[model samples]
Target: MSDHPFDVLAARALRVGAYLVRADDQGRLYDGIGLKPEHWRRAQTLLADAPEPWQKLLTSDPGDDRIILPNGGHILRLSSNRRGRHEHTILAVIEPCVCSKPLGQVLSESTEADSGCTNVTTPGQCNGCAAACLSDPITVECLLRCWYEDLFKLGRQESELTKLSQQLAETYEELNLLYRLGQELTVSGDPRCFVQSLCQDLLEVMSFRWVAVKLFDLPELSEQLAGMFVCEGTTQKTINEAEQAVEALAQMPQVHKPAVVLDIASQWGHLLPALGNSLLAYPLYKGETMYGLIVAIDKDPEAGDISSVDLKLVGSTASQLRIFLDNVTLYDQMHLMFLGTLEALTAAVDAKDRYTCGHSQRVALLSRQLAEALGLPPDRVERIHIAGLMHDVGKIGVPESVLCKAGKLTKEEYEIIKGHPEIGANIVKDIPHFDDIIPGVLYHHERYDGKGYPHGLAGEDIPMMGRLLALADSFDAMSSTRTYRAALPRERVLEEIQACAGSQFDPDLTPHFLSLDFSEYDGQVANHKAGDPGAQGVAA
Candidate 1:
């Protein structure tokens, strides 16, 4: 007896009419259990000529197969392995046959009506028929059909599993790409920056010779390109030539097609000499409005052929890009409209008094500079600028008699003047998108020692933006000529600001503010009342 456990088990099973056989690639049997020489020879011959139904079991890694012997006296269940230590082995169990005749003979002799043998007779009454026999051909045929159906169902299930796995893998890859794209693209508020980041992200996920985004003039598709953003793996000349070619192709009367992948050479053969041929063009649209076009030129050799999956990915990305671009456009329009309204308000404030004409604009310009000098962020600086322009908006509510009184005011008049900051804050407090600017508008007049303002916010207790604005507002007020006094000399103004740094201005911020060059603004302000369209100035 072999000491190997598998051999011992196989020997014991074979004695009970089951067997184990191992064969090599050459069809030569290598091991056997519980079989006479004659039986062993017969099994080899049978397997060598196994029917097509057994092909899957023989070729697959490890699985089961059932077969009826040619003589039809035995049915066998075979477990096969195409891998591991028993790589060439097929272990089988012999099951007693249901029919004496071969399966084929039984099937050939049976009819569909024979399948309903049980239903043909009443409960106790005997309906004599050949199908009622102990080894009925119909029963044998039905059993064989069921086994065959089970095998087919198993095969179909495996096929479906393979397809499902492939689809899942593709979905995972697509989601990963989208996640990366969102991280890279959504950080910028500028449309051009957004498009540039998009191009870079696409190149990371896919292989392309060049990627380009073209935004069109909206509400009208007549202009083919309003703006173009491109990232190129090839020469700029090649990209430029290809862009021109694509533009020309768009003008063709035959090119009224939807977004799709196309053979670049076939569509624009004349331009093939200057540009490589494989490309995809996708139109960006929302509803009936066509926004733009996104194009990829030449698939990278490493990326293989562009497939339906690639097209699907690109289309999904384009849809998201469309929404982002639309939002950016809308924001820009709203921003311009807001600026126009603020400019009109500033103009009205200037109209209240001739000497104070353009005072708000100067303050706004200086405040932005001071905010920058203090190392505030761009967004905060922009808020300060707007606040400076609107700081005196409450002056509109003040009686012109007091505004242009041309002499020192009584205590009550001075008290009313101080209320402008509170009134300015109240005026804009309800306007949407002005939340950050309101603090600066309300506290620009607040003294560093807590002595000034409609509110007594002082020292560090004042908002940082309020402190910066206070310095800017005071500097501009002292520099500009007024009905009561001529403008202070620059040196004298600087001396006074330095003298009052801790008392009236943020001492920590005053040095940085004083360090900035106001020469460019001084020149502009000097020319302001002489009639320039608008004062153009910048801080150094």
Candidate 2:
């Protein structure tokens, strides 16, 4: 065959593969790869017609090197390496050009010659190519093998790149779905509805075959978080199968251990009967405590689809779900703490005055009843109850001489006593835990008519919880006994509660507080201090 342009050039360079490089005039060295004056000579010959300096000349090197031509004209040196250890020998081998499938198929189908076919030389001769022109008989053989390895390696790398791209795309889509689901859960204040949405999202977004969420039962929680399962196909048979598997898992005793189990069928043969071929179970934990387990089962027909790497991804996803559940639990705990502290603070205030040992508690109980009667928001009602409980907490700073003087306090003493609202507000201001409740305690004493102390924020300007607490506090104070006077009659207390509606109490809240049975407060007060209005009062 007549020599082609690439073949002629490659022959002159004494190299096996086609490649090119740019020569550098400035000599420099890094290990054996360096620039020398001889490099510029070869480059000058290749581009003889070029301008002076020859800084950008394409060079013909009898060495292994690669050239990159940007925009098809500007050539540059990409890489170069030594091919021989002890001699001035180099072969410019370019990155393998992708071979056509026809070429590969031919090579794969060719039979080995009787001469052992130890190298590509024998195979080339069998294919009727000139054997003498090809360099060292063994060289041709080694080159053929090397090219074959490189071709397959390139194909594998391309495949891995495509796979990673697809996985990244899928991850982005799942993250978007997670964000939307979080929004829906937040807006869905109904616990059951939130959980239902969570279950559906876990199935639709995560592609889990079976998903179940269970919550830890606690005394403070009025509603028990039952098992919620979502699956593509969850019939009685499937559920029974799942239940049996759960029971079997339960038998594997782990003392408060939260764990993730993979390929669970291998460990529990019983799981095989009902479960998919692959199972991944993650335990939901709050702190170090395991609340429950979320199990994802996959029985896809393709075995290769669920690899160890895949199971790890599923486990990580389950951890995010666990975090959401933990946050819900935390929210509940915070709500409870808010209510409890408010109650304790109110009780502490009542304890300071012997005559009102049970007064604060009775008012709180009445305030809760009134809040419900007035159809107030549950969260608002909760704040009101807390405010009522701690409404007199500032009294903790009040001296007993003033509280139990058994006589009307002078204006100076009254003014000092009235500062309790601001003082109580400041006491809890530093506690970030009760952010919402502090406002109620601070403003509960303000009157609707703008006559109340500490910034007389009037009417609707007063926080609804504060207004509600003001009405409840007044009702309890009017009905209870004091050191200087006997308890007022129930009719008189009701008349006062109604007369002061728009002025002293929230008009809407006053009627609700007036509707309560005053006898109930008297009973609670007597019961609370019956043992020792003296010693028990001392404890208060």
> Each model's number of backbone clashes?
0, 2
For TM-score, the strongest prediction is 1
Every candidate's lDDT: 0.64, 0.54
212-253: candidate 1 lDDT, tens digit per residue: 776655543222124554554663365567567656545543
lDDT of 1 at 536: 28
- Write candidate 2's Cα lDDT for 328-351 as tens digits: 656767767866766666766777
- CA lDDT, candidate 1, residue 289: 58
Supply the TM-score for candidate 2.
0.53
Candidate 1 least-lDDT 10 residues? 117-126
**What are the runs in model 1 whose C-alpha is more than 4 Å off?**
1-154, 168-304, 432-435, 449-451, 455-458, 488-500, 515-540
Candidate 1: TM-score?
Answer: 0.59
Per-prediction TM-score: 0.59, 0.53
lDDT of 2 at 414: 88
